[model samples]
Target: MTDIKVDHIIETDVLVVGGGGAAARAALSAAQAGANVRMAIKAKWLTGGSTATAFSELLAIAAAIGHADERDHPEIHYEDTLDAGRGFIDPELVWTLASEVPHRIQDLIDIGLNFDKQENGKLVQGMSDFATYPRTCRVNGVTARHILVALGKQIKKRGVPIDENMMVFKLITDNDQNISGALGMNMETKEITLYKTPSVILACGGAQHIYKHAVGTSDMIGNGYAMAYELGIPLVNMEFIQIGPAAIKPSMTLLSGPVWKTKPILTNSNGENILEKYVPENVSIDEVYTEKVFPFTISSAAYYLDTSIQKELELNPTPNGGVWGIMPPGSEEIVQEKIPKTNGVLKAKGIDVFNDPFEVALVAQCMNGGALIESPDGTTKVAGLFIAGETAGGLRGPDRPGGNSLAEGQVFGHRTGQAAAKHAERSTNSANPEGKSHAALEDLADWIGRSKGKQELNDAIVSLKENMYKNCLVIRNEERLNDAMTYIQELEYSLENGEFNIDQENFSAAIDFKHMLTIAKSIVLSAQTRTESRSCHYREDYPEKDDANWIKSIFVTQQNGEMSVDTRQWPHHRKSEKSEVKL
Candidate 1:
């Protein structure tokens, strides 16, 4: 541990790291629980994260509100969620979320989140992806955006201190393994700031953009994942990431639901339907397009569509690294009404989705794995350290249930914030002990020191992304995965050994490159260890799910600078909280 002078010291009861919907909701919950909370964000306040820019009405938040149908309830939602996860989810956590999300949605409504309402004064809910009923509630196409707006207003009204442009670098722990505080750097001022808090909530989202082609926000690198790994927190299902065919040309928006509803024929540049050629004879193009609207699950045949599209891109080069998606006639009216956002975005790019063969490709959509947390409370193995949102794993399993991510942010965000605040109130150690922040400071210093004359860092990032897309995305096998592991290990070695000059001006990019590479290593390592195809983690070598051997979730943790991959079977036969409702 190196001795470094501190620039600024901030004392709070709770420190929420991130600026997305989860972070905001956590802050609000903490404040309501009568704790002083401070939120640190790397970007501009209330912008640039996944929650701010997510699209698709199908990306709706699931809460069994029973609006569309009276039979819809939490128990049914729980079963749907469990089925969507393929029975590998944390039963208690999934239960808590499925039971509590409707209440959280009501909380959002109280804070001015206006869902589309019906004429009879009920919230207009719709069915999407994996649900058996219309339980998803949304406001047009931008559900998460509006939820963020509502939560932001609440945080502002409660007078929570939000420090923008402050990139949190490390989580500080005390001698007893308790979270003492956190450290961050001011991006604009270039000054280090120490946050002395008893509780820290990590809502730092996912690291999906490690692949070259991804439908993630620009800053959606896995800093939280790296921090968790560095601090020895075990991650679950690290190999399971949702992948799907998305719009590439007119913007990287998801080309599901609306686009698929138009009966769009996915073809090559030569106007050849390739799904029939590559997918199993049992799967059909119409069924894949209609049934697999958004979520990319291996259980569903829709994944074949994504694989076929990717193969088309690789086999036949199209404009802008995308394939042709030709919609049938009368698509113009459907585009204007159902997919106004798609129409407007494509219209600006001089491509009419209704009349033209828009470019689309298989892209990295969401990560279903992250740092594992205890059920109902969102606490990690480390005391006073909690995780919420996409940063926390185990709530999801091999595949994702549509809209659960947003609901999770609200549900666990509220629970984690309340839990952290209560813990902070009971704790006495509010100050950072001597040398507690030293290791974190050393890393920050290392990042600063090595960031000089390092233009190759950008090249390394590009290479990492390209290699991940080539070896890890959509299709995976033993040979390609091994090659990826070798390349990544070499890059990690180079970064540690200072083999290349890093750009000082682009500190964020350098950090992003490291974090992305770290998560990519975790994904590849977990993927290699799990020798069976299940959910989103498909191995061509092991083409079928092996329940006898591979039914357990893979856990990846770091020990003595080396990765240790392990697995644990789902406990308690996947019993949910709402077990009263019979299927």
Candidate 2:
């Protein structure tokens, strides 16, 4: 066996593997708890993760602080969250998020983060889709960016070390299956480093980029999901993915709250209003527009709006593979008033929404499911390893209320950080896992050495993305999902057989493609197992929500080197029934 050398070995009490808001907050909390924390990111600070990327004109952070509405409270938020989750949420986690997000928001404010406020110094909370009250707060349209910046400032002030452009590919575990450390490579220099830590936090975000059209940054290719799955962690609710409309032509920004209010004219390549064709006669286009916010959910008539755009793209796709959406004559005034930041962004890009028609497509937004956690502290079955933010699953379900993601990140990030710190303090340092690290490197070396063909990795990635977008997007069915699964399996086989060339220049991309393939297959398998239409996961073959049978969440896990699927009833299902809130 050929030996692969590790360039550096560093030790920390807690290692956070991500650059987003969750990772930043986790590092801050761990440091505040007196743990020596370090951060490693695949991209430069503030440019790689979903938290730093601008998705919409108004990215809301939901918390029931009663600043905007007196009736709003944590209990209402908890009930609303359960209702939106469709009985698939972890009630304890939901309560933790609902009750603790206000404190986390206060922490952000204490660290110099300012939310939008009214003239009287009260917070300007807005109503997000599926929410019962005005509970979402924002910083104009770029809420995530501002939150990340604030968290970054705190991380710096605490003197937590951050290693930029370090792509972690393997989680090194001891013979007992406890997390010992992690192995990563410097993207720029290709130098491998081993992180020796008693505790590790996985906050690497979601795998939305596996789809052709997605709102996530390119680096969010399911690093956390892939690593956890490799370590035999179960992922839940993988089928429930948020798909929504986004401008694809002039600029790739989410066409959410304010954009829908414009009541834009949606047309196909033939310049015909396509919404009228898809929307039923009983449901008017006006009603669809009113119900539409961002994601395509089955509970409202807005589903037809997204279906119309998707069908148009599949049938008569424009040059940009999207349908045309033209804002009305007087809607520019509304845009300016409602989404001034987005309006300026479009104007700067020479896209006059009121005058010219822009291309809009159904883009993958967020993954509601990921690595399953056992507690609010984001602890998985695996000891010494934790997950938070979009990387951790079971906190959300079928349809997440808008702005809940930001709150989840902060809430769980804080909990996971403190818990990991405590775990580190209690842990006794065992012998170094140098042999485990070598085994991981040997596996990587073997894969690279066996490559004898010349198939381009980029082409395979494009095909995977296109396939995922077509079959696994908002509208899904048995046949298409099976086909996608088959294709993914074939790709996996090809990769293992070394049909695709592995070169130094594309090594990192090859690793990312492998992770994407795994994630995409998990999504397809989960979507196929559900066999019902619910929230973002719509099965045309079933076309109905089966609460009696399908209310449970689907779980995917890697067992015996093969992927398996199973189902589990929500932990708080009975309790949820007792406290069910009727809208």
Candidate topping TM-score: 2
Report how far residue 82 has shifted in candidate 2, in Å.
Answer: 1.0
State how far residue 211 of model 1 sits from its true place (Å). Answer: 1.3
Q: Any runs in candidate 2 off by more than 4 Å, and if so which?
A: 1-3, 573-583
Please write out the lDDT profile of model 2 over residues 1-583, one tens digit for every residue: 3345699999999999998888988999999999999999999998987899856765889998888887888888888888877558788888888888989888888898889998988788988876788998898568999999999988999889999999999998887888899998899988889999989999999998999988867888898999999999998999988889988866577887677877889888887889877888888888898888778888888888888888898998878999988787777678777777766777788888788778889888888999999999999888999999999999879888888999998999999999999999999869587888988888888888786677889999999999998988887888889889899999999999989998666678889999999999899999988988988889989999898898898889999999999888775532432222110
lDDT of each structure? Answer: 0.81, 0.87
lDDT of 1 at 370: 93
What TM-score, to 2 decimals, does candidate 1 have? 0.93
Q: Candidate 2 versus the native: TM-score?
A: 0.96
Best prediction by lDDT: 2
Candidate 1 local lDDT, 1-583, one digit each (tens) = 2234568989999999988888888999999999999999888886767898787647688888888988888888877887766546787887788888888988988887888899998888888666888988888778898999889988999999889888787788888888998888788876778888889999988887888877757677788888888789988888898887777875786776666666677778777877767778776767876666665556777778777876787788577777787767766677666667766666787886667777887788778899989767899889999999999998888767778889999999999999999999999874554377766667656756654444488788888988998899878899989999999999887877666675335555666677787899999999999888887788989999888887778899998988899888776345544433211
Please give the distance, in angstroms, between residue 267's alpha carbon in candidate 1 and its true position after superposition.
3.6
